[model samples]
Target: MGYGLPIYHSHCRIDENNQMFEEGREIIYVNASIQEDTALGRLMHDMFCTDSRDMHYEFLRKRVSYYKENEGGKQEMCEIWEEIKNKGKLEGLREGETIGKQAGLAEGKILGRQQGVIEERINSIKKLMRKNGYTLEEALDFLDIPKEERSTYIGIFTS
Candidate 1:
Protein backbone atom coordinates (compact mmCIF):
# COMPACT_ATOMS: atom_id res chain seq x y z
CA MET A 1 0.00 0.00 0.00
CA GLY A 2 1.16 3.52 0.91
CA TYR A 3 4.79 3.94 2.01
CA GLY A 4 4.02 6.90 4.32
CA LEU A 5 4.66 7.22 8.09
CA PRO A 6 1.63 5.16 9.08
CA ILE A 7 2.52 1.77 7.60
CA TYR A 8 -0.48 -0.33 8.74
CA HIS A 9 -0.85 -2.61 5.69
CA SER A 10 1.13 -5.72 6.64
CA HIS A 11 -0.52 -8.90 5.42
CA CYS A 12 0.50 -11.90 3.33
CA ARG A 13 -1.33 -14.97 2.03
CA ILE A 14 0.89 -18.02 1.83
CA ASP A 15 1.41 -21.61 2.91
CA GLU A 16 1.75 -22.17 6.65
CA ASN A 17 5.49 -22.89 6.56
CA ASN A 18 6.76 -19.46 5.31
CA GLN A 19 7.62 -20.53 1.78
CA MET A 20 7.92 -17.69 -0.75
CA PHE A 21 7.04 -18.79 -4.26
CA GLU A 22 7.13 -16.62 -7.38
CA GLU A 23 3.39 -15.92 -7.32
CA GLY A 24 3.28 -15.45 -3.55
CA ARG A 25 2.92 -11.90 -2.24
CA GLU A 26 3.74 -10.84 1.33
CA ILE A 27 3.11 -7.39 2.76
CA ILE A 28 4.94 -6.30 5.93
CA TYR A 29 3.68 -3.16 7.67
CA VAL A 30 5.53 -0.86 10.07
CA ASN A 31 3.42 0.99 12.64
CA ALA A 32 2.97 4.72 12.26
CA SER A 33 3.17 5.63 15.94
CA ILE A 34 6.73 4.37 16.49
CA GLN A 35 9.73 6.34 15.29
CA GLU A 36 11.60 4.46 12.58
CA ASP A 37 15.05 5.21 14.05
CA THR A 38 14.67 3.58 17.50
CA ALA A 39 16.54 0.31 18.10
CA LEU A 40 13.62 -1.80 19.34
CA GLY A 41 11.29 -0.20 16.86
CA ARG A 42 13.61 -1.03 13.96
CA LEU A 43 14.04 -4.60 15.16
CA MET A 44 10.30 -5.23 15.47
CA HIS A 45 9.52 -3.58 12.18
CA ASP A 46 12.39 -5.16 10.26
CA MET A 47 12.15 -8.61 11.82
CA PHE A 48 8.79 -9.30 13.49
CA CYS A 49 6.51 -6.89 11.59
CA THR A 50 5.17 -5.31 14.79
CA ASP A 51 2.89 -2.27 14.84
CA SER A 52 3.31 1.26 16.31
CA ARG A 53 2.01 0.60 19.83
CA ASP A 54 4.24 -2.45 20.23
CA MET A 55 7.34 -0.35 19.54
CA HIS A 56 6.26 2.88 21.28
CA TYR A 57 7.06 1.63 24.80
CA GLU A 58 10.44 0.38 23.62
CA PHE A 59 11.23 3.85 22.31
CA LEU A 60 10.16 5.32 25.64
CA ARG A 61 12.70 3.13 27.43
CA LYS A 62 15.57 5.03 25.81
CA ARG A 63 14.13 8.46 26.58
CA VAL A 64 13.86 8.85 30.36
CA SER A 65 13.25 12.61 30.10
CA TYR A 66 9.71 12.05 28.84
CA TYR A 67 8.87 10.30 32.11
CA LYS A 68 9.47 13.47 34.27
CA GLU A 69 7.09 15.65 32.27
CA ASN A 70 4.33 13.03 32.41
CA GLU A 71 4.73 10.73 35.46
CA GLY A 72 1.80 8.46 34.59
CA GLY A 73 3.09 8.24 31.05
CA LYS A 74 6.45 7.06 32.34
CA GLN A 75 4.93 4.30 34.48
CA GLU A 76 2.64 3.24 31.70
CA MET A 77 5.50 3.14 29.22
CA CYS A 78 7.61 1.06 31.63
CA GLU A 79 4.85 -1.44 32.20
CA ILE A 80 4.19 -1.80 28.50
CA TRP A 81 7.90 -2.13 27.73
CA GLU A 82 8.30 -4.95 30.26
CA GLU A 83 5.42 -6.85 28.70
CA ILE A 84 6.53 -6.36 25.09
CA LYS A 85 10.18 -7.05 25.85
CA ASN A 86 9.23 -10.63 26.60
CA LYS A 87 7.18 -10.87 23.44
CA GLY A 88 10.00 -9.33 21.42
CA LYS A 89 12.45 -11.87 22.85
CA LEU A 90 10.19 -14.72 21.79
CA GLU A 91 9.69 -13.20 18.35
CA GLY A 92 13.43 -12.75 18.00
CA LEU A 93 14.00 -16.48 18.59
CA ARG A 94 11.35 -17.40 16.06
CA GLU A 95 12.87 -15.02 13.56
CA GLY A 96 16.26 -16.67 13.95
CA GLU A 97 14.84 -20.07 13.02
CA THR A 98 12.79 -18.65 10.17
CA ILE A 99 15.82 -16.83 8.77
CA GLY A 100 17.55 -20.06 7.79
CA LYS A 101 14.43 -21.48 6.22
CA GLN A 102 13.82 -18.29 4.25
CA ALA A 103 17.42 -18.22 3.04
CA GLY A 104 17.28 -21.83 1.84
CA LEU A 105 14.04 -21.22 -0.02
CA ALA A 106 15.52 -18.16 -1.69
CA GLU A 107 18.59 -20.11 -2.80
CA GLY A 108 16.45 -22.87 -4.23
CA LYS A 109 14.43 -20.34 -6.18
CA ILE A 110 17.62 -18.83 -7.63
CA LEU A 111 18.89 -22.24 -8.70
CA GLY A 112 15.56 -23.05 -10.28
CA ARG A 113 15.58 -19.81 -12.24
CA GLN A 114 19.10 -20.47 -13.49
CA GLN A 115 18.17 -23.97 -14.58
CA GLY A 116 15.15 -22.58 -16.42
CA VAL A 117 17.38 -20.17 -18.34
CA ILE A 118 19.75 -23.00 -19.24
CA GLU A 119 16.87 -25.17 -20.41
CA GLU A 120 15.55 -22.39 -22.64
CA ARG A 121 18.96 -21.99 -24.26
CA ILE A 122 19.15 -25.74 -24.86
CA ASN A 123 15.73 -25.71 -26.56
CA SER A 124 16.76 -22.84 -28.77
CA ILE A 125 19.90 -24.71 -29.78
CA LYS A 126 17.87 -27.84 -30.52
CA LYS A 127 15.56 -25.89 -32.82
CA LEU A 128 18.49 -24.35 -34.66
CA MET A 129 20.07 -27.77 -35.11
CA ARG A 130 16.85 -29.29 -36.49
CA LYS A 131 16.48 -26.46 -39.03
CA ASN A 132 20.06 -27.06 -40.16
CA GLY A 133 19.64 -30.85 -40.60
CA TYR A 134 21.68 -31.81 -37.54
CA THR A 135 20.78 -34.78 -35.29
CA LEU A 136 19.96 -34.18 -31.60
CA GLU A 137 23.38 -35.41 -30.54
CA GLU A 138 25.14 -33.34 -33.19
CA ALA A 139 23.13 -30.22 -32.29
CA LEU A 140 23.89 -30.77 -28.60
CA ASP A 141 27.59 -30.97 -29.43
CA PHE A 142 27.45 -27.80 -31.53
CA LEU A 143 25.86 -25.89 -28.65
CA ASP A 144 28.77 -27.04 -26.37
CA ILE A 145 26.49 -28.48 -23.73
CA PRO A 146 29.03 -29.67 -21.18
CA LYS A 147 29.70 -33.41 -21.27
CA GLU A 148 29.14 -33.67 -17.52
CA GLU A 149 25.69 -32.06 -17.84
CA ARG A 150 24.59 -33.68 -21.15
CA SER A 151 22.11 -35.98 -19.44
CA THR A 152 20.48 -33.09 -17.59
CA TYR A 153 20.33 -30.97 -20.74
CA ILE A 154 18.82 -33.82 -22.73
CA GLY A 155 16.30 -34.51 -20.00
CA ILE A 156 15.20 -30.88 -20.00
CA PHE A 157 14.84 -30.65 -23.76
CA THR A 158 13.19 -34.05 -24.18
CA SER A 159 10.74 -33.39 -21.40
Candidate 2:
Protein backbone atom coordinates (compact mmCIF):
# COMPACT_ATOMS: atom_id res chain seq x y z
CA MET A 1 0.00 0.00 0.00
CA GLY A 2 1.27 3.47 -0.89
CA TYR A 3 0.89 6.02 1.96
CA GLY A 4 0.35 9.67 0.99
CA LEU A 5 1.60 11.22 4.26
CA PRO A 6 5.00 10.99 5.99
CA ILE A 7 5.44 7.90 8.20
CA TYR A 8 6.95 8.46 11.68
CA HIS A 9 8.36 5.47 13.64
CA SER A 10 9.74 4.80 17.12
CA HIS A 11 11.12 1.93 19.21
CA CYS A 12 8.53 0.40 21.51
CA ARG A 13 7.97 -2.75 23.54
CA ILE A 14 4.74 -4.09 24.98
CA ASP A 15 4.44 -5.24 28.55
CA GLU A 16 3.12 -8.70 29.51
CA ASN A 17 -0.25 -7.16 30.28
CA ASN A 18 -0.61 -5.69 26.80
CA GLN A 19 -3.98 -7.08 25.67
CA MET A 20 -6.81 -5.67 23.60
CA PHE A 21 -9.75 -7.98 24.30
CA GLU A 22 -11.97 -6.61 21.53
CA GLU A 23 -9.39 -7.07 18.69
CA GLY A 24 -7.04 -9.67 20.30
CA ARG A 25 -4.07 -8.49 18.24
CA GLU A 26 -0.47 -9.43 19.20
CA ILE A 27 1.76 -6.33 19.66
CA ILE A 28 4.88 -6.09 17.54
CA TYR A 29 8.00 -4.17 18.54
CA VAL A 30 10.12 -1.93 16.30
CA ASN A 31 13.15 0.36 16.76
CA ALA A 32 14.40 3.35 14.75
CA SER A 33 17.61 5.46 14.97
CA ILE A 34 18.58 8.83 13.56
CA GLN A 35 21.56 9.18 11.18
CA GLU A 36 24.54 11.16 12.57
CA ASP A 37 24.40 13.40 9.50
CA THR A 38 21.03 14.80 10.66
CA ALA A 39 20.80 18.38 12.00
CA LEU A 40 19.90 17.32 15.56
CA GLY A 41 22.78 14.84 15.64
CA ARG A 42 25.21 17.49 14.42
CA LEU A 43 24.00 19.97 17.07
CA MET A 44 24.39 17.40 19.85
CA HIS A 45 27.88 16.50 18.62
CA ASP A 46 28.92 20.16 18.49
CA MET A 47 27.60 20.94 21.99
CA PHE A 48 29.11 17.89 23.71
CA CYS A 49 32.44 17.75 21.90
CA THR A 50 35.52 18.76 24.03
CA ASP A 51 38.24 18.79 21.35
CA SER A 52 38.23 22.61 21.05
CA ARG A 53 38.87 25.41 23.59
CA ASP A 54 35.78 27.42 22.69
CA MET A 55 34.35 29.44 25.61
CA HIS A 56 30.80 28.66 24.43
CA TYR A 57 31.26 25.06 25.66
CA GLU A 58 31.92 25.96 29.27
CA PHE A 59 30.44 22.73 30.58
CA LEU A 60 32.60 20.35 28.54
CA ARG A 61 32.96 16.78 29.78
CA LYS A 62 36.68 17.04 30.53
CA ARG A 63 36.36 20.38 32.28
CA VAL A 64 33.39 19.17 34.33
CA SER A 65 35.26 15.98 35.32
CA TYR A 66 38.41 17.95 36.10
CA TYR A 67 36.56 20.40 38.26
CA LYS A 68 34.90 17.55 40.10
CA GLU A 69 38.15 15.68 40.67
CA ASN A 70 40.67 18.50 41.36
CA GLU A 71 40.64 21.38 43.84
CA GLY A 72 42.45 23.78 41.48
CA GLY A 73 39.92 23.24 38.68
CA LYS A 74 37.06 23.53 41.15
CA GLN A 75 38.47 26.81 42.39
CA GLU A 76 38.71 28.05 38.82
CA MET A 77 35.06 27.18 38.15
CA CYS A 78 34.04 28.90 41.36
CA GLU A 79 35.95 32.01 40.39
CA ILE A 80 34.36 32.03 36.93
CA TRP A 81 30.90 31.52 38.39
CA GLU A 82 31.51 34.32 40.90
CA GLU A 83 32.67 36.65 38.16
CA ILE A 84 29.56 35.93 36.08
CA LYS A 85 27.32 36.49 39.10
CA ASN A 86 29.08 39.75 40.00
CA LYS A 87 28.67 41.06 36.47
CA GLY A 88 24.93 40.39 36.60
CA LYS A 89 24.67 41.94 40.06
CA LEU A 90 26.54 45.06 38.95
CA GLU A 91 24.20 45.47 35.98
CA GLY A 92 21.14 45.13 38.23
CA LEU A 93 22.55 47.70 40.66
CA ARG A 94 23.15 50.18 37.86
CA GLU A 95 19.61 49.73 36.60
CA GLY A 96 18.23 50.14 40.12
CA GLU A 97 20.27 53.32 40.61
CA THR A 98 18.84 54.82 37.43
CA ILE A 99 15.27 53.95 38.47
CA GLY A 100 15.87 55.36 41.95
CA LYS A 101 17.20 58.65 40.58
CA GLN A 102 14.16 59.03 38.32
CA ALA A 103 11.78 58.35 41.20
CA GLY A 104 13.66 60.81 43.44
CA LEU A 105 13.42 63.54 40.82
CA ALA A 106 9.69 62.95 40.37
CA GLU A 107 9.17 63.07 44.16
CA GLY A 108 11.23 66.28 44.40
CA LYS A 109 9.04 67.94 41.77
CA ILE A 110 5.85 66.94 43.60
CA LEU A 111 7.21 68.25 46.92
CA GLY A 112 8.30 71.52 45.31
CA ARG A 113 4.80 72.05 43.88
CA GLN A 114 3.26 71.29 47.29
CA GLN A 115 5.65 73.82 48.91
CA GLY A 116 4.59 76.44 46.41
CA VAL A 117 0.92 75.91 47.26
CA ILE A 118 1.72 76.09 50.96
CA GLU A 119 3.66 79.34 50.48
CA GLU A 120 0.75 80.88 48.60
CA ARG A 121 -1.66 79.88 51.33
CA ILE A 122 0.65 81.29 54.03
CA ASN A 123 0.87 84.62 52.19
CA SER A 124 -2.93 84.71 51.92
CA ILE A 125 -3.28 83.94 55.65
CA LYS A 126 -0.73 86.65 56.54
CA LYS A 127 -2.59 89.24 54.42
CA LEU A 128 -5.86 88.30 56.10
CA MET A 129 -4.23 88.56 59.55
CA ARG A 130 -2.57 91.96 58.90
CA LYS A 131 -5.44 93.54 56.97
CA ASN A 132 -8.18 92.36 59.33
CA GLY A 133 -6.10 92.66 62.58
CA TYR A 134 -6.66 88.96 63.28
CA THR A 135 -4.39 86.91 65.59
CA LEU A 136 -2.22 84.00 64.12
CA GLU A 137 -4.63 81.44 65.58
CA GLU A 138 -7.66 83.31 64.26
CA ALA A 139 -6.15 83.60 60.78
CA LEU A 140 -5.27 79.92 60.71
CA ASP A 141 -8.74 78.99 61.97
CA PHE A 142 -10.42 81.25 59.39
CA LEU A 143 -8.33 79.62 56.61
CA ASP A 144 -9.64 76.19 57.80
CA ILE A 145 -6.10 74.88 58.50
CA PRO A 146 -5.84 71.81 60.70
CA LYS A 147 -4.49 72.54 64.18
CA GLU A 148 -1.79 69.84 63.85
CA GLU A 149 -0.41 71.33 60.61
CA ARG A 150 -0.70 74.97 61.71
CA SER A 151 2.72 74.90 63.42
CA THR A 152 4.42 73.75 60.19
CA TYR A 153 2.87 76.67 58.27
CA ILE A 154 3.69 79.08 61.06
CA GLY A 155 7.34 77.93 61.19
CA ILE A 156 7.73 78.32 57.42
CA PHE A 157 6.07 81.75 57.13
CA THR A 158 7.62 83.19 60.29
CA SER A 159 11.15 82.06 59.31
Give the top-scoring candidate (TM-score). Answer: 2
For model 1, residues 48-145, the per-residue Cα lDDT tens digits are: 43333443445543344455346876766764664465446445645654674577756555555555566466556656754786766787788777
Clashing pairs in 1: none
In model 1, where do residues sit more than 4 Å from their true spots?
A: 1-104, 157-159
| Global Cα RMSD, each model | 24.4, 25.5
Residue 80 Cα positional deviation in candidate 1, in Å, after optimal superposition: 66
- The window of 10 residues in a row where model 1 has the poorest summed lDDT is 46-55
- Candidate 1: lDDT of 119? 47
**lDDT for each residue of candidate 2 in 1-159, tens digit (9 for 90 to 100):** 113212233333455766434444454322113225555444445455455343234455556567755798886677467546545644564566567557875655555555556656767776786589787788889989888888876754443
Model 2 clashes, total count: 0
Measured by lDDT, the strongest candidate is: 2
Relative to the true structure, candidate 1 has a C-alpha RMSD (angstroms) of 24.4
